[model samples]
Target: MTDQLTQVIAQATLKDGMRNSTDSLDAATHSAKKLARKLFEGLDEDKGGVLTRDEFEPYFKNPADAAEAFKVFDKDGNGDIDRKEMRNAVSRIYRERRALATSLKDMSSAVSKLDGVLLGLALLITIFIWLFIFNPKGTTAQLVPMATIILGFSFVFGNAAKNLFESMLFIFSIHPYDVRDLIFIDDSPMFVLEFGLFSTTFQRCDGQVIVAPNSVLFGKKYILNVRRSGPMWEATKVMVSFDTPLDVLHEFRTRLRQFVTDHPREWKGGLDVNIDFMQNQNLIQLSLIPSLVVAMEHKSNWQDWGARWDRRTLLMKEMKRIMDQLNMTYKLPTQPVSFMSGQNKSPKPANSLLGAR
Candidate 1:
């Protein structure tokens, strides 16, 4: 009877263990089925019943996790899982395993690409160092040559590096030109001032401090004063009487054009002449515009090409010469006279003056 009792006790214990195992399995199955039902419900919303890859993919961390979850849900031996069957089978087992797996893969790929770039840079640096150290020449002789090469390369590379760095900083919206350019304050006759990479700081002739960029200096339209091969920036305008006979006026224009053309080195280009008749006053005005380059030292002696004195001198000389040759009466008009008084004049009709010529 004792032996029988021992066998019954052992059997009872075995049965209990089997019952626990069965209970645990049944619980897991129930949980999985509940999760599958949730997933099916989420995928079959009224908005759109079809489950696309993006919709299904978020449930699992990766493809493998997704495959495993799908295997559990697809219980009917069919490759595709119907909504109701999937809901009754595998949702709890998958979690977000597919998403986690995909993230890991992407991170790995990024790290690999970064490693390749770093390796390439390291290899290039190693080659450069080896070339500098292992040459056949004796140490001292090689040192000088190597130093020279390195210095030259550094000079070029340094500027390039600086420019590239500045560009990068600019792209990131940072100001690189933070330091104020030095202003050269001097009363020296010669405009000698220090210049920086992008700006020149100097005192003008009037002793005013000016800071100008190299780009502005190079890009602007400048009037070069060609006095002793330097640019000059001076101009003059002259207005002459229109009462001069047409022949004499033509001669004067021809002479001025010829003079400018003959002395090409004196002026920037050729003289610009404008002649117009004032209809109301019945007078013609001749404007001669010319440019000349003068030496800096001879600023006191330099005469404006468009000055009244210069115009008178040139016009009188030419007029006298022409009058002596042609014996023509070419009188200069004293001044412009108005044909109509201010409020006393009626508005002239349009076509009346239009067809007057």
Candidate 2:
């Protein structure tokens, strides 16, 4: 038992000695560092004066010192110092110094901003407390809560209200078309498929559907295609040689009108076939415009573009047939191109005057 107690005593004594040695060594190291710094500073000659620890100590005290410190760190030696540079220098000082003085100033500024926000909250709470305690039964209390509720509602649903309001206005004063009506926006043709309280939906010829806000449609210009409602007409240019007389154009127009009238399937009754003279040159260009209004009416293919295409194809075929009957030829405008093999005059004939000499 005595030997065991002695062993415990020795162990405890060794641990105590080691701990004391570590503490003494740490103290000696710190003192040595301080002495080294003092010796280094004493040996240096400050030919170029610089701000010392004491001189810079004041700026670490408060936010107002940002100006004074700016003047110190302005390496460009500008007479006027900027506040932003002062802030950057403060940040660098914290990094280089690793001391509590400059950090305390930054901590204080952050705490001040936080305190202001807390005070604002406290003011709001105080107003509520006063209202509840003193005027709980008054009309002002009732109106205030109602106003708050309305303001909150508007804040959350303002965009929805704007959309709905514009949609209703558009449906009344601006809407010029109905469902299935062909309309054009930005020169692109689209068929109206559906209308919503907030948006109008359009379907393209490719079967793709698009939905756009009503407000956008209301503010933009659109065209309602009246031709789609009844018969449709398209025009193309026909070219003929300049030798063709104006009488030929009139004759073609008469024959074309008669052919379309007889078909009854390709041409509408109200509008006649028109042949207008265009550019006149070596090649005479005539605008040949005919209608498929009667075809659309007789076929009653309101939404079938394929049926319309077939009607157009039939019209073109009839035009060709009528031209063949009238012995009228269709010409394409073309420019004659001449190529010179060389600058030499035209080659002499095989037995020309030059060969006879």
Candidate 3:
């Protein structure tokens, strides 16, 4: 009888274990379905029932999660998930409980910092108001000292308040375009650092910082690479040897024009090439002007494209190809001759190039 009872107990234990395993599997399946539904619901809101990368990305915490989700959702061998397939897939059961906890912790820290700043500002304002209301009155000897003290404090506080208010206004009034919108100013290229209420600060590509007032930026005539809303303007000037043949010069212009035409994506629109002769010192100067317009908005890094090594390399290669085609000996000058100064100091009649020479 004892042996019979032992066998029955073992059977019962096995049955309970099987039941637990089945329950765990059911729970896991349910959790996965819930997660998948959440992901699909987010995507389905925009479309009738579709999933795109942009729509699905916000649900993923990291690249690995995204890859895994994509693998599960991609029912076909196409390597991407479509709306219908994504809705059909079972979601994973793992909850992002840790991520939610971390986010809440960070939010608390930010709120604490903001509160401290507000308290400090409030205290400073209270002190200023107290001093203004409790002015001291006495004999001329004591009155003069009191007046001086009040004046000194007033001057310091007034300037500080003015600066603070102006900064607040500037932050609230930021617009699409303002003074800090150009690649070059006064013909000198620089990197814009920040735009403030009263002044603008910029660092040159070579690491020199320049500070100019807002008024100065508004007043200046500078070349701007305005994105999408306008055309991208680029000017290239080449000075060829005086002895270069006219055929060589014409070939150079043609090659430059062709290069611009070939690179449709890089050079968006038409090309303008101007060839002119002038007198430089006692020698003849041949100028090849190529102005190409690229859609400023299309270039990925319009603001910093010039500083990119790859862009510079591409530009240099194109320039070298043109130079080789023309068989021209040329000098790339650091500065271009200013037409205003050149015209103003002309020694001969305005219409005649020979007379000027």
Best lDDT goes to which candidate? 2
Name the lDDT of candidate 1.
0.45
**What is candidate 2's lDDT per residue for 207-281, written digit by digit as tens?**
889998887877666765542455555667666666766676677777777766775533553334444554545
Give one clash count per candidate, in the order shown: 17, 1, 0
Cα-based lDDT at residue 115, candidate 1: 62
Output the number of the TM-score-best candidate. 2
Deviation in Å, model 2, residue 225 alpha carbon: 5.1
lDDT of 3 at 61: 82
> Least accurate stretch of 10 residues (summed lDDT) in model 1?
175-184
The list of candidate 3 runs beyond 4 A from truth reads 1-151, 174-204, 207-229, 243-245, 280-301, 306-313, 330-357
Give every collision pair in model 3.
Answer: none
Give the per-residue lDDT digits (tens) of candidate 3, residues 1-357: 224323323332232345236664466445445545665665665665555455555667887776665655553334545444543343211212222233344335434644576799899778756665675232434657767997998888886556545543443343223323446666676645455455556777688888875444543445443332343445556666666777776776677678766754345435555555565632344443433333222233344344334444565588787777667675543343333346567454344544576
Error of 2 at 28 (Å): 99
Ranking by TM-score: 2, 3, 1
Cα-based RMSD of the predictions, in order?
A: 36.1, 36.0, 19.3
Candidate 1 residues lying further than 4 Å off, grouped into runs, are: 1-192, 213-236, 257-269, 276-279, 291-357
* Model 2 stretches with alpha carbons more than 4 Å out: 1-139, 142-159, 172-175, 225-233, 270-280, 294-304, 324-357
Model 3: weakest 10-residue lDDT segment is 91-100
lDDT of 1 by residue, 29-123 (tens): 45555554555666655545434344555666787776665555444333555565454333222222322333344345534644675698799
